[model samples]
Target: MAMFVHVTSAANAPRIRRSGIRAVSHGQGDARGVYCFPVLPSYTLTHQWLRELARFGSRGGLVAVHVRLDDDEEVLLGRYADRARNAQATVPAAQAVRRIAELDDPRGWEVFVPRAIRPRELHRIRTAPQVAGWRYRPDAHGTRPCTCFGCRVRGGYGARRLRERLPHPLDGPPPPVRVLLARVAAAGEPGDPVVLREVLHWFGMRRRGPLDRLAHLAAHPDPGVRKDLVWAVAGWSTPGVGDLLDALADDPRDEVREAVEAVREPE
Candidate 1:
């Protein structure tokens, strides 16, 4: 059997000790699982997720609840950089533990077990290294501002201004202002979001108008259109966009909510 650790707030320690970690996402609907890190040979790596969990846990000290799983148990594995549901691969529990141990530096990897960890599988609970792990993501410290708009903290101090000003090296030149406006004006109501989706890319946030023209997309039957609308509104400084966002925030689809939270102001 391979061992893993689930880092959580101290407030949860007691309940976990009594009942084991449940098979449930904290709140999200589809990410149902117990998120954990495989216990590796390196102590630093084994407990690397401590700090990151505690930051959001905000329930006093943090603890690592050790779990022992059968070698044949299946689990989802992925880079921590991706969203929880975006699994990179699924492998046996022992393989995940063995693979991480073999890697020189598997810094951003994480594991997710799909079922409840029974108390019998709970090996032990202990204080984890509070200083371990990365905040936000592994490359965040002293790195260039993340160019992927969805991944960065948009509401952080000066963030909106910074995103507006800087373009990543890999980005192609944005469309000419006149051309972007013309595209929006010329755009027709298509059943598919593909046409308007391309127009949003032309805007690139430099100019913020034509809100009335793009408003229909907010409630389009296609969720891709709704999500695209959220991304487009994120760049513009126009009014009515918030109302659009408010409507989309309540969308039933997980992808739509993910887009809304990605750009929505920090609450």
Candidate 2:
């Protein structure tokens, strides 16, 4: 009963079925489009199909297409959403990577995921309870470079230079290097300090430029943050940095005061 505006191939129909989508006859078209019954796959299967759809959609192909899911499909998406939130197994994470690779089309992969799952999933897999604590699969290491901002910033030219650069996870997160630093510096005054501190620390474990930004952050409002910034900057020791430290020589906070003294001390 539910029909596509365009005639679909029998092959495409099966593909949809295999994809955990069931076509339900809802007496015909609905106001939204076509209403089909949902095919509920295990959470793993749902994750797989979503990744596949995203990857496939990203490929420059076809046109703007709307996929109308039946009531069942909507319910399944919610179920998987819940499963994803509560997932305690690396199996789900590994499945995520496998499903993405299966898509073959990076553009399409971007099109289907939750934005977070596409790029960050690898990281999550690496650190999560299931994958991180248990095993390391060199195969699952994502030969493709992560397209997320964090990966680009941390990986630098190395990630770009690599032959395979995967699309970002659902088009967001792992923010770009410049964007991350700018937001960090702007935090609290016109932004949020917690977000700034979190990102700064995240950068600390990754690359170098973030430290340079930190040095200039001595003027930050939070004394503790300023102290951390000073420590990060001291690693680089640029010209006139000594003078900058000298200016803060009398800071009341012991940490800031010590940083200023250490930075200004004769070599």
Best lDDT among the predictions, by candidate number:
1
TM-scores of all predicted structures: 0.57, 0.29
lDDT score for candidate 1 against the true structure = 0.75
Question: For model 1, how does the per-residue alpha-carbon lDDT over 100-155 read when each residue is reduced to its tens digit?
Answer: 77877788888889888898999999877689877766657897666565654545
The whole-model lDDT of each prediction reads 0.75, 0.38
Model 1 lowest lDDT segment of ten: 167-176
- As a whole number from 0 to 100, the lDDT of residue 122 in candidate 2 is 18
Query: Model 2, 215-236: lDDT tens per residue?
Result: 5556766776666555545544
Report the backbone clash tally of model 1: 0
Which candidate number would show the highest TM-score if scored against the true structure?
1
Off by over 4 Å in 1: 26-31, 81-87, 147-149, 154-267
